[model samples]
Target: MPVDSKLTASSEKLIPEKQIAGKLLAHYDRHARTLPWRAPPGANATDPYRVWLSEIMLQQTTVAAVIPYFQKFTTRWPDVSALAAADEAELMAAWAGLGYYARARNLIACARAVVRDHDGAFPPDADTLRSLPGVGAYTSAAISAIAFGRRAVAVDANVERVVARLFAIDTPLPGGRREIDAAADGITPDARAGDFTQAMMDLGATICTSRKPACGICPLREDCAAFRTADPAAFPVKAAKKAKPHRTGHAWWIENGGDVWLERRPDKGLLGGMRGVPTSVWRVAGGGEGDSPPDYPFAGRWTALSDPVVHIFTHFSLALTVHTVRAERDCMAGRDGEWWPKADLASAGLPTLFGKVAAAAMREELPCP
Candidate 1:
């Protein structure tokens, strides 16, 4: 029997779900990417801790960037109970270079929740898993399916692209997400659901890539609506992006005898629970005007530096001017933070934004009086 080369638009002409699943599973059996977090095909399920950790770290971050961090975290804290028991500061420092500091905070909270509520075992069902901190729909589904062998559809960006192309969904995302999820649900097999989900992810990551998808060798090419149209990459249509808002602020660089002033950010909001230099509050333009300067931490001989540190966040861009000051040795006596040795700034666990600020200060060689 021959599969249809061109699928009709009618309901009866929809691509056969079994054929797509069989072909994709066969391809996965041969070409699955050997990630540190995933178990081998037909092997026993992977540790739930590894699965959950990888999923959280991989959010809005590339796998290549996450590999070392994942290895470090697992080596340091192998199990949920260990992670739950770890100190918050140590965990935040370990996660310093990894952006999205909020995730680190939530990771600790979720770990503690798991240890307290679930006895250090992650809930096996998707709905129950979502109740845990920071675990959203996609992550919950992924954990349930991959870690517990439950029948669930875990659609990440990769799987979204693959599904959108498979069905030739022209509606732009997030609008198209519903249709993509539906299509994914329809094709997901009753058995080996975990492998099927991972297979879809692998296919999207390796073959059905966002740019120049290898449609010729794709397992589901015959059933792919986008492949038949000769533009498989045009799918998972996205809405036009609005320009990110820009903001400007200042960071005080107060140094005394080879030590700099650093403070711990509040345990809530942006850069939460991380160490950084004192700075102005980030503000949006009001009535088409720049914001007023924030109050200084303490009066000192402050000199403005020409260079500014520019950092981009998920929702806004920041330009922080560095105000160098030679604070008297006694001035910082009552301050809440430590006077960290300048030589050891690398280990200060500054968020990437503040790290850039430190680099700018170093480049200018702001002398201490």
Candidate 2:
């Protein structure tokens, strides 16, 4: 189906795409936000590595949360070659607090791929960029436009909302994304595709916000379908979200001498490839009296803590019962994990869920290990 280019005005006349683009670009020149990963407007394009790294870190995360992480990552691994050569454990440790461990794992893979396959430089086109690990359509398009000056439509959540409101797209999201993308493609100017993309992002983040949009100051207000109806915020309608499921599990803290038992999680699954204490399988149907103690790594008197550590993931809520026990020095001597010192657990780089469990276990008086 063809996109209706006509604005929602009673006249129903087509708004020139160039006029919208020009107005937006003009607004961008004055109001573009200064970000650590972005070059100033009209400046030379940003490095593809920075663009790619920022995009990955920004996924399902806010800019404020990503800023320090981006700074730390760039400082430690300044370029693709350095990132490619980084030790996996050290890299994951640096990425510990950043939720979504998969991104960190994929970051390592993508960095190595760029160094090995693309000669330590990112591919300049969207299709080629998408071939890299963890680089999806939105990320590939963002890198292609912002890093290599390609004419690509980089529609992130912000751009999606802006386009949805601009066109008064009533279709609920995921389905409406197609119309939003088409509308975005229509306004994407031939020149400064990078700047245009950023402008749309800035407009959405600042003026055309999700809640109360500042339509009076919006550059495209005259051409906006939602604004014509005096209900700009009503657009970008979303479908009702399903209630997230709940699950329960257990983490055992076994201490001997000055070390605690910590094992590396399997290479695939939730919290994969990270070091954590032994835990029971987190399942939906096993929360109440059916929740039984998992097999202990070594025989010892186990004591369950009073409070459970509750953490929320994207799909479900997890309640982790923490159990602690003191064992002999030689207990589980040939186990699959190392005995990490209890004092240095903070630096052990446990994921947030395990970290919470560790904290809950530590509140009780136990032999220092």
Candidate 3:
């Protein structure tokens, strides 16, 4: 039968639920992405550690980018107990460049909690798993269903798009979040609920993409109302977002001969515990009026440089104009700092963005215009 006719039949509850189940299963068998978290054929079970790790990494990150990180973590830590025992510096280093440093911190905290509170076992129930640090409702549902085979409604961005389009739901998300969850739960199957949850995620990520959905290839095309109406993109409506704020700060570029000075940032703010060139507080004004040079007891020529270095945090974009000073080695005694050779800076573990700025400095002369 034609897709439109099938959808029409399904809409009125004329088609048997068994038929829908059969078609969805057949579609998934032919098209599902073979992922690491997936239970291998004939495997007796899934590893909770692997499931938890992948889910955490997948948060706000793509699968392709996450695979290598996931592999590295598992290879190093292997399980919750090992992860719980990871040194703070080692764990943070492993997580560098992944962004969201706080997630890495929470990953360590949750691992330790799992080891301490649950005896190294991830809790099986959604409620219990939700109690773990960084485990939100969606994550809890995903881990519980995928790792423990509990029936749960895992609503990710892709899943949300797919559900909204399938039901022709015109309500704007996240205002529509609740309704969309209901629609997803309506179609969630009982047996292999885990597999069904994963299938939805896969379908959304692939065939039912946010842009240019492949309706012809979608398994649910026969029953997708928005596709028949030729307005699938319109179903998952959205509200316009407010513009992100922009802030300005200054990084101190203190060099003596060929060595640069760097200090470890405090443990609780932006870029916490990361080694960086001493910087002024990032604020609403780009190093606004009254911002002064950092207190350095040593005497040096502080040359103000132009053309700010820009970086985007999750909530805002930052433009940091820097000031550089060439100091004598004897002057290092006046400051609380470490002298790192310009050549050895890379091994000192600079964040990727700062590393770029440093590399630029190496390629240019003073002022780095």
Candidate 4:
């Protein structure tokens, strides 16, 4: 048979979506990441809650860390209904140390939304799935494709790295995200597209890694433009790193008869609307040191405690020193702030950072680590 020049040209120009899909499927067949969400063949099971929960937990968190948390959550709550009925304080406590409090709040909201609006059923289609709280394009696509077998593209960090390297595009991250998404969409296959998406994730995470990529083991190494050029490391261009801002602040430590007082922060700004220890304004001072105490939540024989708790926010770092005080019996009313017994402190919904500060203060450790 005469050689088909057009087929050859097309193959050279761009790997056909189907073949790209097939190659990845074969790779996955040989080595799929053994995730709990993946349904076993002929198991006859699918839980949207499980899928949704995993996707949410996986955000800004690694799969290895999220697996145990996932196991704990599903084992504890079991389903949307159970999670919906779960006490808010307990939910927040369960979500402690997760960092993002908004995610936890939205998780509860979305769970309730699922129970109320969807009759405890997660929408299988991407469009309908996106309607849920905390769900975005990537999350919706992930849940739809991974759980419901819907054809959709999920562009997460791992997928972004894979696409950027394959095309040999170095537009720079965050800024180059759009270009990466377009390239990913171009290569996405029709059949078993879901598996292909996950394959890309696995390849990027394990083989086409950000640093020290195992190009020799990459299934698509032959087709990778970056690999062919012998500069896979240089493929993903990056922008200059900006210095993170540092803010100075003071967190109040009000103790009364071995009980600690905590407050629910306003529903906006840093740690918005979450339960936390009372804090003064978080800003730097003229001397480049932390600002002075802005006044206690109320007035009394307020004694300043030594040392501070330093926390790093996305935009800035906060070095909060404790200024404890022995308040009088009729201290000012702490609106939304209550005094909880030291023993029962864990029940209230306090942010992990604050919880750590509180625990350290209770221990009276000098300069808490």
lDDT, candidate 3, 14-42, per-residue tens: 43344555567677777778886678532
Stretches of model 4 off by over 4 angstroms after superposition: 1-9, 12-15, 40-45, 285-290, 332-334, 365-369
Q: Give the TM-scores of the predictions, in the order they appear.
A: 0.92, 0.92, 0.85, 0.89
Write one digit per residue (lDDT tens) for candidate 2, span 300-339. Answer: 7888788888999988998888889998767867778988
Looking at model 2, residue 275 earns an lDDT score of 88
Where in model 1 is the C-alpha error above 4 Å?
A: 1-15, 285-295
Off by over 4 Å in 2: 1-15, 285-290, 293-295, 367-369
Can you write out model 4's per-residue Cα lDDT over 163-236, one digit (the tens) per residue? 88888888988799899888888888766656776788888788988888998888887777898876787768
Q: How many residue pairs clash in each candidate?
A: 0, 0, 0, 3
- Superposed Cα deviation of residue 107, candidate 2 (Å): 0.8
Compared with the true structure, what per-residue lDDT tens digits does model 1 show for residues 71-109?
999999999999999999889989998888889988999
Candidate 4 shows a clash count of 3
User: If candidate 3 were superposed on the true structure by all CA atoms, what would the RMSD be?
Assistant: 4.0
Q: In the order shown, what is each candidate's alpha-carbon RMSD? A: 2.8, 3.9, 4.0, 3.5
After TM-score superposition, what is the CA distance of residue 333 in candidate 4 from its true location, in Å?
2.1
